[model samples]
Each structure stands twice: as C-alpha cells, then as structure tokens.
Target: MTSNMKTQVDDQMVLLSQYYPGIYDQLIPEQGEVVKPRRRRKKNKADGNSSMMRKRKLSDEQVNLLEQNFGNEHKLESERKDRLASELGLDPRQVAVWFQNRRARWKSKKLEEEYSKLKSQHDSTVLEKCQLESEILKLKEQLSEAEKQINSLVERSDGISSTSPCSSFSMEAMEPHFLGGFGMEGLENVFCLPENNYIHGSLDWMNI
Candidate 1:
C-alpha cells in the first residue's frame, strides 16, 4: 500500500474501531499501523475453486428484465445489458448472467411452439391419409359393381343373339309392326329394334 492508501485504511480503521473496539487493533496489529504486504497463495491444481471474487449487487427487477430479454431476443438482451450496466454502473458480467437466464427461457418457449406445430402437422397428415384411403376403397367398390353389371349385360346379349332368329334381320322391316305394340314410353326407350314379335335382350335402362 502507498502512503495515500495507508492513510485511507488508517482513517477507515479509526472510524470502524468506534463501532467494534479492538477489532481493527487486533486484525491490523498497530505499531503506528505499518502497511503489511499481502501474501499470494500457491494454486492447487486439484482444487476447482477460483481465485476470482464475485462482484455487484443486483436488484430483482434488473436481473429479471435481463433474463427475460435474453429469452425473447439475444441481440436486444446484449444491447440492453450493456446499456443497463452502463446506467447502473455495474460490471458487464452481472448483466451477461441475467441475459443468459433470459435466453434459456426464450429457447424453452420456442421449442414448445415448434413441438406444437409439428404435432399439428402430424395430426393433419394422418387425417388426410385416412380420407384418401377411404375414397380409394369407395372407388374400388364402384369399380367392382360396374364390372358385375357389365358381365350380366354380356350374358344377356349372348343369350338373345343365340336363341332369337330375329338377330339376323334388320329393324327397318319390323318398324311398322313394332310401332303398334310400343306405347309413347316404349318408343322413347327403344334405339335399335330387331324384326321379330319377341323382344329378347336385357334393355339398358340407365340412359332412359
């Protein structure tokens, strides 16, 4: 310690001795209060303890705000911490720790949002896949029904042609005679007619 520092320490000791008498005298060991040189301890590699001392007293509001900003915005947290530290005349490390906590909080919130969105997408995709599968099943059923109908029609047509002699004749020859048996509805239903008294095939009624 320098003369100026010794003077200051001595002045502090005198003021402090009034509150706790003999405390300063015992610790300081005064013979006119000679300034003692501080001893440096050798570092033990096995010991994890740090020589660095903690600094700065922080308020809840300041700590909370720094932490909160870190979570919401890293850039903003850094800028705010720097600005706040400057304003409060605190070390940058104090502000940095506050922002670190804030960032962790923000990361948790962001992860939650992402998880929710992924879950929503997964649910929607499942629904769409189920719907498409149902539609495919419905289309397959329709195709099966249509095939049965077509097979039935083919059998009926074959029977008609093989059993009916009228299959060889043109319809123009039988038009006048057929016109008498056909009512207004029958005429509407017929497209091609054969020259015979017996009408001998399954009619396709779907168009009518």
Candidate 2:
C-alpha cells in the first residue's frame, strides 16, 4: 500500500481498536479481498428482494370482500383494518397494502374518465367551428358570383342611360351604397333602376 493509504488505515484501526478488541497492526490484502464485501452486500440485497416477492396472495373471496370495503371507503382505519383482517383470514398489514394498491388504481381510473370527457368536449367544439367556417365560405362564394352579375347589369344600364337624359343610374353614384359584408339583398336595395331596364334573376325590381 502507498504511505497515504497506510496512514488512513492506521487511523481507522486506532479508532476501531477502542471498540473492537481484535485489531491487526500489520495489514496485507489479497488480490480479491477488497471486492469480497461488495459481492456479499449485493447478494444480501438480492435476497431481500426475493423475500419481498415471496409474499402470499389473497383468495378470490378475500379480494372481492376487500373490493367491496374499498368501494365503501378509501381509507383503512386501524379498527376497521383489524375487523377486515379477521373476516378475510388475513393479517392487518396485508389488508392495508391491498387497500393502498387499490386506491392507486381507483385514482388512475378517475383521471382517465376526466380526460375522456374533456377530449369529447374538445372534439365537439372543433366540429362546430368547422361547420361555421364551411357556411361562411359558401356565403362568400355566393356573394362573389352576385357581384359579377351586378357589374354586368350596371354596364348595360349605363349605355341606355346615356341616350335617355332622364335616367339617374351610374356606377359612380351607386358605389357609396354597395357594401361587401351585406349580402345580395343589400345589392338589390342599392340598385334603384327604372322598370324600362332588363330584369335579372329574383332581383325584386321596384321604384326606390
């Protein structure tokens, strides 16, 4: 061993010697001796895990009764745990552990139910929004078609108006009444042409 390592071991020995009667003054470690304690510790940890996994499971009747009790109350009071243990032919600790595991499963079930409800609501909202957007797009398409026809009729009216000096219709004067947001009905209201003009589709012509 190095001088620093020897000094550390000497200090440890001196400290332990007061409590431990058998202490070695001269120390020498074999090749594998340093690794032995870690191997023993690892083996003991494995044995502890194996023992925990070996716990006995309860019977069907015991599980059903435990489920009924859990449905009635989530918590296991000491008095109730003892009574349940006696009735189910189990230890109180076993009953407590079962209830603890059952409560965890129950909480997960409630969270799943809540998530499903919220997801359904979100889907419904998305569907409604799509429907509204489709209707708005359809209206916009209809309005664009109507505007094209109106422009055609006004151009025809302008030729007839120039020959007859009494006619008051012009594209410039009609523009102030035209609004994009107000659909085809507003277009009909804006165009107050005389009965001598040609009639278009369903545009209820009357004097302004």
Give the candidate number with the greatest TM-score: 2
Query: Which runs in model 2 stand beyond 4 Å of their true positions?
Result: 1-55, 158-208
Tell me the lDDT of model 1 at 185: 29
Residue-level lDDT tens digits of model 2 in 44-135: 44465666645466789999999999989999999999999999888899899999999999999999999999999999999999997788
The Cα RMSD in angstroms, rounded to one decimal, for candidate 1 relative to the true structure is: 24.1
lDDT string, candidate 1, 23-112, tens digits: 434576558867543333434554665544433346777667655655566864556767878865667776676567666777899999
Screening candidate 1 with a backbone cut-off below 3 angstroms (N, C-alpha, C), the clashing residue pairs are 67-102, 70-103, 71-102, 71-103
Candidates in order have lDDT scores of 0.59, 0.70
At residue 106, what lDDT does model 1 achieve?
72
What clash count does candidate 2 reach? 0
Query: Candidate 1's C-alpha lDDT?
Result: 0.59
Q: Assess candidate 1 and give its TM-score to the true structure.
A: 0.44
